[model samples]
Target: MQVIATAGHVDHGKSTLVRALTGMEPDRWAEERRRGMTIDLGFAWTTLGAETVAFVDVPGHERFVTNMLAGIGPVPAAMIVVAADEGWMPQSAEHLAALDALGVRHGLLVVTRADLEDPSAATELAQAEIEQTSLGRIEAVAVSAVTGRGLPELRGALARLVAGLPPGQPGPVRLWVDRSFTIKGSGTVVTGTLAAGALRTGDELDLTGVAKPVRVRGLQSLGRSVGEVHAPARVAVNLRGVDKDTITRGAALLTPGRFLLSDLVDVRVHGDPVAGLPATLTLHLGSAAVPVRVRPLGADTARLRLGRALPLRIGDRALLRDPGRHHVAGGVTVLDVVPPGLTRRGAAAARALVLEQLDGVPDVAGELRRRKLIRGSELARTGVDTATFPAPVAGEWLADPAHWAVLQDRLRDEVERHAKENPLEPGAPVEALRHRLGLPDRALVEALVRAPLVTRGGRVSAGGPAVPGDLIRAVETAFEGLGPFAAPEANRLAELGLGPRQLGAAVRAGLVVQLAAGVVLRAGAPEQAVRRLAGLPQPFTLSEARQALDTSRRVAVPLLGLLDSTGVTQRGDDDRRTVVRG
Candidate 1:
């Protein structure tokens, strides 16, 4: 589907032309029909070849120009209907200026009411005026709804006009509502040009300025019910859980979490910001026109504080108008959706330096670099797709990849330094490591350390001097000669120069066994005991275990206790134990 909004002087036959094209009435209110003018927006659609093109008829009266802006702001394509008799009037220029400020370039210059006067001159005049604006030279089609002159040609041109337009914007869903109301049985319904992206039935979307999200009960595109609707087309959404009174023009229906919402935005204007802006202004973007306060940072850049939070993307162009002073001040190109507060000294200058780094589109990489580390949710709200985003140090904390690599190296060096300096103490505590890296997240510290720098018991250190090569050789040789159940005597261990520290180290390193004091046994003694006991009985006593393993009570008691501690056995009430053979 395609949508085009009408722009021209009052009573220039914009609505009349729409009726002639669609064969449907464009006026929805009695006052509008009686007054012979569009007081608010009206909608109509007609089939142009294989496509259905929806027409948004906007009023041309200067008194309701803001209402006119609301109707046309979201429609990508337009039809500027100029009455041949009134040729190129004030509203014609103002409407064109609004479109120009919004950067709308795809449209047709239509000369309506050709029966009253020759349209060639009017067409030429309107075309020349448009040439001076962002909508450069566009061919004009002369037509009369009264005489049906050039109606067929106008229809073809409208189709071709939409065809020549650039492909629709690609992004998540954003529908700027122009009209919202309630129906007897259908609940709340809001109509707008689905400006970008798509939505489906039952999809929950965040409505800017409203805290609660609304769900799509049903969807209609170009006035037909559908399960889903894509953008750049007229959409009437049947919404659930929200009242009609709560919705208004400028409210945005967005795919939740994809777009940033804020009351303040930093922008780069087309001209000098200080000279081109008023203290109080109206900001018009998408389908919204809201009052705002501007703070100029430079000739081209400034910050805007809207009446309420609105969703805007980087590089979005908006019209800034001083209602009491000037109609169109300048076009504002958004540079940052999340601007910093200027409460501190030199904050303005510091902010300007940050703004200077931004390019036309958002500099996500540069932003991550500047912050060093930021919450993943913050970046998500920036609408930067994380699937295509660069990898971070850990989940939910974004960091510059190179910076994170540097952090890893720094962490390793610190751990190595701590261990070399304090070999007796378990490396440095996690808290110290967290502080050294200047990281607020403790989990990042835990993820950075591994291997030679070991982590255990609320501390980190290099693994115990690699188990002493000489002790490894001595213990392995002695353990090979020990009996399955019988133990190594303390005198024998001392003879081999294995002191208490050496034996304890061997036990911790999984090389030797110490069941109790003077009851050191073979390394695989527990495994041998479990197997022999599992075959002995349903439950076995310490006497039976010692008899089965042919080991003494001194070794047997602690070995059973070790088995129980390791869950190899479960002790019953009568002091007997059973093998937990899994």
Candidate 2:
């Protein structure tokens, strides 16, 4: 099924034409029929040449232009009505401008009320006006809903118009609710034009501004219940978990996590110059009419601060209207949903320069280049296909190749600098490096480690300048002179010239381990002590381990603490120590 909206001036026979084609009243309210004018949106459908076509009859009065915009925002095709006697009218031009702003291309120009006057002049004039907009040159038909003159030709033209429409591809569902109400037995139902994707009966969807997701209890298309309905169709969804009073027009049922709700957006202006637009204007997109504050960045680009967060994407076309003046300022193509803040001086100008290069299309490579780094899920939320881009540096963390290379170089330099600054502890902690680099995840830092730089035991280091063999040998010879647990005193180490730097080098080289200040032991002394303590008994006191190792109290305390820290021994609350066998 395909949906089309009717656009024309008030009393131009738009509803009459729809009723004549579908053999059903397009207006639902008795007041509308009694007044002979459409005040709200109405729906009617008919089968045309083996294809189901749905008509969203919109109000053509200038006062209800907002309602008219809501009706045509999601419909891809339109039937622009022009009365033969009236020729062209104000609402006719306004609706046409809206369609052009939204980029609606497939439509038919209908000259209604043909019996009142010759429709040739009106058809020619209306066709001429449409040729200047996005609709371009389209099929034109003259018809009289009263006498049914040229009705067959109008239907044939509409059939061809619907046939020529591009097939709707399955994608993230964003259904803008035009009407919301309660049914007798059902809880709540929302009717809208399903522009893309498919809706299933049991699918879960996120309703805008609602805390919890709503379930699709049932689905209906063209007044018939269905399990699933595809895009380009008018659908009424029976929703669970939300009340009719809360759900209203302008709220959308969206595929959760697929869209990004943004209050600030960067857009490229079309139709009118940015300088002519007011600072505050109403933005119309989907079925929403939101007030916005505009900050002109360039002649064609600007930043819009919306009153509320909306699920927007790149390349979305919408209109900006001056509600006070009752005129459309211009059309806008969204270039960035999550834009940078313009707080610094000249930042707006710089952003405009960058936005000038964007074409409003979702290009993953372009996005990565601009953002430098972003998560895969965030890129997807912007309507970009992450699969088309290069593989991420870490899990779902995409980085530009050049920027990633720079980060790797920076990481290497930071490690080298850290070693130079603090020779005793050369390696930098992983968390410190992550914070220094402003990386969002520690895994990214781990991925940045290269050949010379290595991460081990939660520290990243470029294995600090290999300890001099002479210094390592000196430390080893000093330890060999004493028992395995007999660490030399600080004064004794001074005699051998084993200062903190020398001891640190020996530790890095695995020749000696510094248990604590002034407590240096051979590399394997902790393990050896654990083995000796394990033979003593199930649990031994620190004094008993000290006696068994034959070491002084200073050496024995740090050694036992080291063993406990390294998981080689467990100390109970009673101050008894036991070797951890496993």
* Model 1: residue 106 alpha-carbon error in angstroms: 0.4
lDDT (Cα, tens digit) per residue for candidate 2, span 373-395: 99989988998965687888999
The alpha-carbon lDDT assigned to residue 440 of candidate 2 equals 91
- Residue 545, model 2: lDDT of 90
Predictions in order: lDDT: 0.82, 0.90
475-550: candidate 1 lDDT, tens digit per residue? 8666666568877777878887777777776776567688876567656768877888899886888899889898
Q: In model 2, which regions exceed 4 Å deviation?
A: 463-474, 477-480, 494-517, 530-547, 557-582
Indicate the residue-level lDDT of 500 in model 1: 75
lDDT of 2 at 262: 91
Model 1 steric clash pairs: none
